[model samples]
Target: MGVGGAGCSAAFAIASSQGFQVTGCDIEKTSPYLDKRLKKFVSIGHDPAHLKNSEVIAYSPAVTSFDSDNEELVMARKRGLEVLPWDLFVAKELLKNKFVIAVAGTHGKSTVTAMVGVLLEKAGIDPTCLVGAIVVDWGCNYRVGESKYFVIEADEYSEKFLNFTPNIAAITNIEFDHPEYFRDFDHLKETFKKFADKLQEDSVLIVGSDVNLKNNNGKTNKVSGPADLNLKMVGGFNQKNAAIAAAVAQELGIEKDSIKKTLESFKGVARRFEFIGEEKGVLVFDDYAHHPTAISETLRAVREKFPDKKILVVFQPHLFTRTKVLFDDFVRSFTEAPVDKIILVDIFAAREKDEAAVSSLDLTRAIVGGKAKYIPSLEGAATYLVKEVSVGDVVITMGAGDIYRLPTRLLEKLEGKG
Candidate 1:
């Protein structure tokens, strides 16, 4: 259900491409993927009646977490119809008899997955791909190719990635995240170890140089991209992601020249330092970096790219649990970055109740120096930025939530159309 989400939307598209009659519904009325991919629209919300014609129900993780007792789910259980989470459905049904290359990590898995898919495609493998973010080259989050190869981004949240028995896998990097689910850092690491163990006996597990897995059954390859490789994307983290992709491509017998060519030309997935056109000489960009490490790396890259420009960050904390658990880290990330101004919006609180102990204002207060301000709303942040930002300033709208919408709103206001 929750097909409006990136993962579910890609699953819907992949299932449909495989000739399944797919119909979906989400709390959201529309999304880019829904508009482009979904052919059948069920209702906007969960309804038991929607399951009458369905033989199987594949739901997103959000639906399972937020609406556990949803009417559709209840109806499906009462009717004895098959029900599966999106990842399990893909792993069990779609990946059957295919050469699966699943990329799993705490970060950069989406980009790495897209890169591997593109590399395989360039080498005439014609592999099917399902990524968490929209690959700019494919114009969608998925690419359907008629081949035995299946490439996918294996998310570790809720331990959903364990369902896949991949022929090859990559771990870009690992750190403590999803504080809501994991008990502790060791627990998170152990879960990753289990995911690594899911690899077949002869399967190759390509890991970044920074990854430290205690034990893995598969043959592990520690790789890092060449320092001199020219890439269009910014950041050393991206170079690391490319290296892992190259390793995976190499395992699949793709040549070095083809892999390098594909990696250099990759336009990158949407919302990962994606450039939104400049308005009134203010260069704007959007990114989906919710975690502290991601924020630090992203801002560092932006600062390195535009050393002299006044970089303004409008950040919205994605989840209250994360903000509370990693509160100090969040403060340090912003304080350490080479940013000039910081605007903090309210926490997104996705699928979680508001933790009265924590808020964006708390984070703003924690940041050292007089650089951060709590704006409380996206609209307020946009309005403030419209007046505060000047020519040559680099503005970045960053978060995993609805913060991506602000760049367009800010640009419209800058253009005097909003």
Candidate 2:
């Protein structure tokens, strides 16, 4: 897998559990996740030459530059070594043993996926779950289990969801995403409809109650479609996620009481509006809100949860292409929030250059209520926060990239003031 966020964690989890002889080479060698997983076998740097002896090459979605490695993977194919995408490989292997609850959506997918995994484990379900976060309960992103269920975070990138035929499927919302891969909004929704149809006949399909499903002939938020069912999970987004999971559990005859117990105990994911404990009356949070829609939804959730708190948002743009393509939406994402302050960081630029001339400053200017600026690095941003952030303030660090380090460092600095 490429040394990106979720992919890297998932690779480590899989390697730990299966005790498979694992070797990894990535452009980023010092990453803690990769360091821990491939301690003895890191090739030190990414070179396709190492792909020579590998039986198959499994890759993440952000592997655009691997055109250089095509020949190496192709040579393995010539030798009948299977080349597989990570999503498909997980789905296929997961189906072999375990009850899988595959959560799929453009955003909130990771948060909700992590939520179910944690809740189930805490309730003594003893089920194995794979999530987008490094779940503390399992000590990694992937958990080895003796149970019959395999809960997984199903990704929708490049139609990766098509690989697994799920007993349960969900659509958090149908928004236009991954402009790099998909053509238009309709095309993306149609792809989801196709995935919904692939669900088991008597199974369930959970959808965002707000979005309309035009071609979903299967179960939906309808009279006959399984809409009216009760889910114990809270928060507007989580309610939707829980509704989908509940529909699946009910279909499988899981006791409603058991499901309700699971939802109430759900603590939620690490970085999706996750509360990172309070320090000196300041509430710190981290959210994986990289996309425009995701940023909007998470801000709305925060506003709803903390109606009166002064919200200080530290946002870092994830991909340059996404920032350029969804520039207007990104501009409007914070409009609805009565934000007290905003600190914008330089674009994270994952696998894309700033050819489109989009930058965090562009977004800063477009937002009306909150003031924003382009703070370029994590250290500088954290230093700025130490001075500007006031008590009764909620410092929410938002992004999908290494922006997580900012809040962590800021917290450390704040604690030192004690």
Candidate 3:
């Protein structure tokens, strides 16, 4: 079984909550970022022997990165083991038994899922949660409770969420970002519509008012106003996330007082504007904002939180195909953000090989306002920031790549440890 973020979360849910013997592996088993729990059960590389006594083999998006010729999958098929994608496993094992509340969207699925989990738990419902991000409250990506409620971050990548049966579904906001999977905007929109249509006659759909879906069939309860709670996080967009979360909790008969208290006290998940530490009066925050809209919203949120602080952004593009396809949007994303400087690092090729057509320097050049620079290495970017960053600056390492580790290096360099 694969053990990426989503996959690891699912594995943890099954092992910790359901009390199953869980073993997992990734292509890079020795990776520094590999979950420590997974490292205990996972082997260094995939082998046919690993699948010898397996009952079911669950795979993550990592397996699909190879497209079709995965050897482990071939061995599983040859051995006649029950194979399922991780999301399908969630559907078969967990969602089928619980009152499923699935959150689906491009940008805010992880955050919204975590918010719902925190709110429900704080409300004493004790729901089982399978979120994409590491919930700081639980110190893991999943929480296994005895209640019949199961909250999951329903991902739309490859239409994985369509398999999950959700009695209550929430779409935070819809946009086209997964360029490799979807053909165009229309194709992505239709996929979302299909997801919305999956709601049963008695089910409810919670959506943001900004989402322009014409065929929701009046089952949706739109979140159009500010939440009644005092949000501790930054950004007006978080208010939108809170609004949708409140709507979901309200549908479940959770009291407004409890919802308000939980939403206000809920600390965010890891890597969604996670503040690492301050070095010499400079604050470093890490965020998973690879897409254009996410980048823009994150920057705006930072600006709103610290009005006088000069913000420096060090962004690593996630995939090569995403960079090549959304080149214009990427350019506009940085230009639109209210940051003082932009440091563009090399693209982190998640699954695609570099075709030499597009580079980070090209993105830096395409950006207007002359506020960006191309730093080839993460250390180089940290070194440059060490000299240039001031006392009242906020440096955010933005991307869903290995760049999350860069903030620590920057902090160390600022402390003269490098």
Count clashing residue pairs per candidate.
Answer: 0, 4, 0
Question: How do the residues 1-418 of candidate 2 rate in per-residue lDDT, one tens digit apiece?
Answer: 5643465457545645766555665556655344364555655554557766676566665554445455545565667877677676676664575556777777667655665665566556666766777654454566666677667777666787887676666666667887766787888887887777777655556666655653244465421222232333224666666666665556555677877776665555566676776776778888778887777767777777788988888899887767777888887876665577888988887766668588888888887764776687888888888887778889999887789877778888888765
State which candidate has the highest TM-score: 1
Sort by lDDT, best first: 1, 3, 2
Estimate the TM-score of every prediction: 0.97, 0.84, 0.95
Q: Which of the predicted structures, 2 or 3, would earn the higher TM-score when compared with the native?
A: 3
TM-score of 2: 0.84
What are the lDDT figures for the candidates, one per model? 0.89, 0.68, 0.83
Candidate 3: give the clashing pairs: none
Q: Candidate order by TM-score, highest to lowest? A: 1, 3, 2
Pairwise TM-score winner, candidates 1 and 2: 1
Highest lDDT against the true fold, candidate: 1
What lDDT, from 0 to 1, does candidate 2 have?
A: 0.68
The model with the greater lDDT, 1 or 3, is 1
Candidate 3 minimal-lDDT segment of 10 residues: 7-16
Candidate 3 residue-wise lDDT, 168-222, digit = tens: 9999888887888889888988898898887655788888887765324436787
